[model samples]
Target: MKKFNYQELVDSEQALQKRSIFWDPAIYEEELKQIFNRCWLFLGHESQLPQPGDFIRTYMGEDDVIVVRGKDKVIRAFLNACTHRGNKVCQAEGGNTRSFTCSYHGWSFNTEGELAGVPLEKEIYDNLPRERFGLVPVARLDSYKGLLFGCFSESAPSLIDYLGDIAWYIDVVTDSAQGGLEVVGAPYKTEIPGNWKLPVENAIGDGYHVAWAHAGAMSVVGAIGNGRSDNVLGINANNTGVDQSGAIEIVMNTHTVLTTLDGQSGYALYDHPEPVLAHLERNRPNVIEKLGELRGRQLYGSETHIGVFPNVQIIQGLNFIRIIHPKGPGKFEVWTYAMCERGMPDATKEIIHDHVRQTFGPAGLLEGDDGDFVEAITHSAAGYATRQMQGFLGMGMGRKAPWDGPGEASPGLVNEACQRGFYNQWRRTMEADNAYGVIGQTAPVTPVTAVLKEFRHG
Candidate 1:
């Protein structure tokens, strides 16, 4: 009747136990404290809260939160629930408001989270403890390049240290243009019946599925590969060289990046106009100067995929960002955003947004295909016997060799190195007794000396 120990459930260096990790309610509860509470989870972007009084309602773990820009032009998040009866104070998803009023009662709180209004100040209770009932604020909040993040634990690491080498990779997309990037419009919000980790793992470094799981979708978009052999499965048929030596997969702590380095050939799937394409070319010097020559060549006009630790995924080539909000052990809310270059032409922005919506948005066929598989895994893993077995992550374990670059680089684009790295970090955090100890550690250093021969950047 007892299951394996938590250590046995997640042998992230090799494999992970399929069932208990995915279906156990106890482990999920532990995740809330050890993982979500301690980590810097993504909140809304600064672009969304550009003006004072602007606000957007989002979540940190299962807790409801409202990110608001106060009159002082400072962004802060408070618990969305009113302190009086625990009723929701702000019902609107987002708006510019001076204060939030509870629908259940007349208790009102100002943008700064101060108790400002009460139904009966001196009539019912004679003297009300207004100061004691103010809405609670999140323990810690920080941002990186306009991407806001909040942590429930005060002792959590600074957001920069938390990002580590992955920040450099993110700068490729976030800092590509002179003015940086901005979300085109509201996010495409949808709920899916799947574990939160399912999408995280897939986004990080699951290029293996694109050729197979999305083969039909790719065919519709005329991206199924030019003159490549297409069997009934139509997989591994892309001759675009995106999966060849041009593709590099790097696993950095919990974050992962898969980038194509073979020049402009990587944009074969995109149909942007010449002017739009030239925008990236104009920014080539910025990338080269910010990142070294190696990363510069790899990221410029290249198809890039990124997974930011616990739950943020970005496809730089496609100009979209995905935030996965865990609902429970079996469900999650997927927030997809169309990210456009800040100073780009209006037509370019429209092209980016419309293309993103057609390919990976809520109504996208590619999303539908991914949902089917994600739900299937969660649905079938609930079996009593299946929980006893484990899932394989040994794809490119020993195939990782040192590169003349940053992060842990492996050979194949479809490798499981990133997946293994993800689970390994998850296991360490989930098993730690103290959140401070986990966040206090320095950024993980990949021992390149042990992994490959000495090489120099030309």
Candidate 2:
């Protein structure tokens, strides 16, 4: 069912992709089989369900899933459908419940995904086989920090190995605050008229779009003296972009990181930033003590954007996380979460939640700008002539990053090297024969010590 050359869909060397990928149903089907089925997919944060019997309904490549905390306090996930007659189960988005009862027939399942009861087992069914009727379970479940993920393949690499070098960059944010990060409120959700891949590509490393696409949002943000520029948000005293002398774009086998060695704007866009700044200042010594000045100062509060393969994105400075879920070939849903330090003051948490909605939430100014553009780009591919056209992501092509970080680095934040890395990873998964082929393609993890080079961008 392939309509074009698979090799040309994403050419690593040329840093280009065919426009058909955005509009083709056949390609989207292949993505479901190869990418979503094989890789670990983000579920929700552990903080969302702290006690036994708690559960949330989510998706794993269009497959409805129920992620629950068992009586043993272990997190588990299973297909969100009753075994008998294959009826839908657990319709509520999320809540604390001892068991899920199917609407069609009163079939119930325990938090451990075991069959609990049936409407008429003794009279109607006459000794029905209960052991074989438990919910189908996800093969692998793991956590990185507080984030939960479920993978369908048993043979896929461990979550740590899967994250590769990008893990080190994330450590800067997670390790700095002893209390760790948490999801502040329910995610702001909206549907976008675009390919699922579009926003993932945008969030991961499109530093080039900050100044141009987000001109309106940035203008307002800058007016109050917090001029955010560069890959992540950074304050510029002169109202110029963050200095790039120390910035680096690190592209690994299957992940990308855009770091501008001077991050510091975790909550800069908030109207009252005094408390946030004061909080960060109070933690400065501990951050320096634990991570050292290099990581503590540059990557901690500094703005950094991380793009994990397949479909997860983490953008600090804006201080939020989002997942691009594919609805089909023509549309996808964006689920945005406001993230914050766990031990933060209640007032600060309030600020973080509202700030997230104001900037990157579904109706957020910055996100609104991106939604229209990606939609325009995806819809244009529907035209036969346009679908046959090609696109380029060749900015800063062939340039190596000038840093001692984990992966090979590109020179600046505006470079498209990170975007190229994503496409290349996408191509590898789409071309693979099975889950192992995609999971085994990563390079050996670079030792964290070796990644920390004592070089400044300037």
Candidate 3:
């Protein structure tokens, strides 16, 4: 068990994170206690368990948990451990079950986590106290736009507050369709030999990799134009009709953005793009009136991606939310849910699902490229002395300021502001005594109900 100076390992904003944090057993234990045990970890989606008796087994750090829809149709979460002897009660990943029976001793618990039956209880000790032996429930459970989360710390703030400004961005993509979103299928789980934070940092807006790391995939997809030659586009490219607004228009009122491929704002290269365009052409005036010109162009067209911090990552055009769960320091489990509007045509849904499978899933062409980089960085940190050096995140560091952008405050895709914001929030949460401190901070909080209420309502 390699011990680490947590403060020194994390606070060196100028340098690389200490390599020990990835492979050190002692640091992993502390993270299990400080980070995983205290933060609002994404479990699954409400769509996964739409009816009573529906349950899914998940993990917070390494602890097994069961998120279930109770008989009342409300969602609840509990530790998967049996109270009698501390053995894991549920072994399967997810399913519909009326009661969970422990294989070791035949102890059974209902959806509400009440101990329903205990084998040989009367003979064992004149009836052991069943009331005192139910599965231990998690401290807090909540949802945002159908996404579920759980926290072990009793003092943690509401999930809404914890998400802060990121919620606004989430609503844009989530609320694009009329009836909201639904996940297509179970997640595709895999393990990457890397530090958990590396992926999070990457996904939290490491757009710089889109060109070089995924050059082959991008070229194949024809998403890049003249920008293909340079790994990163300079300010010159920003003005050549590829600025954020020209490339993607943010609907400030709605929080969704109108995305275009290489600044081409039309429906040309889509699979069924012709039919969808004809439909839009038939209803152009009304569609334009409702969605506005830019957003209307985005409707049934173009690839738009967004993230709901900590866990959910959605590409609207791709129609999937990749739920990331950190297994330990150097391992992670990714669950991707294919999202689509309820009542979407079967064909449309099928197309969306296939697109997600091709682009982002475990065997996805795009994900394959990024996964290698994530693993290489993790392994490189294995050198004790080399890991002590720094990795530069100062790209566009001092340039970012508060702004009304389509997304959160950022210096676009080329900057590290988003990664910095994620780690900043992460450090705050891990260092706080209780969850309230993490959610209660007085900074540039986002405009979600939880954050607004925490600072203004409270």
Please provide the root mean square deviation of candidate 1 (C-alpha atoms, Å).
7.9
Q: Point out the higher-scoring one by lDDT: 2 or 3.
A: 2
For candidate 1, the TM-score is 0.89
How does candidate 3 score on lDDT? Answer: 0.63
Top-TM-score structure, candidate number: 2
User: Each prediction's TM-score against the native?
Assistant: 0.89, 0.90, 0.80
The Cα local distance difference test for each model comes to: 0.75, 0.79, 0.63
Candidate 1 residue-wise lDDT at 94: 89
Each prediction's number of clashing residue pairs: 0, 10, 6
Tens digit of per-residue lDDT, candidate 2, span 61-134: 88889999999999999999889888888988888999999999889999998899988688898678889999
- Cα lDDT tens digits for candidate 1, 275-295: 556777787777788876766
Q: Which pairs, if any, clash in model 3?
A: 15-390, 15-391, 16-390, 16-391, 161-450, 165-446
Q: Cα lDDT of model 1 overall?
A: 0.75
lDDT comparison, 1 vs 3, better candidate: 1
lDDT of 2: 0.79
- In candidate 2, which residue pairs get closer than 3 Å at backbone N, Cα or C atoms, i.e. clash? 245-457, 245-458, 246-457, 263-301, 263-302, 263-303, 264-301, 264-302, 401-409, 401-410
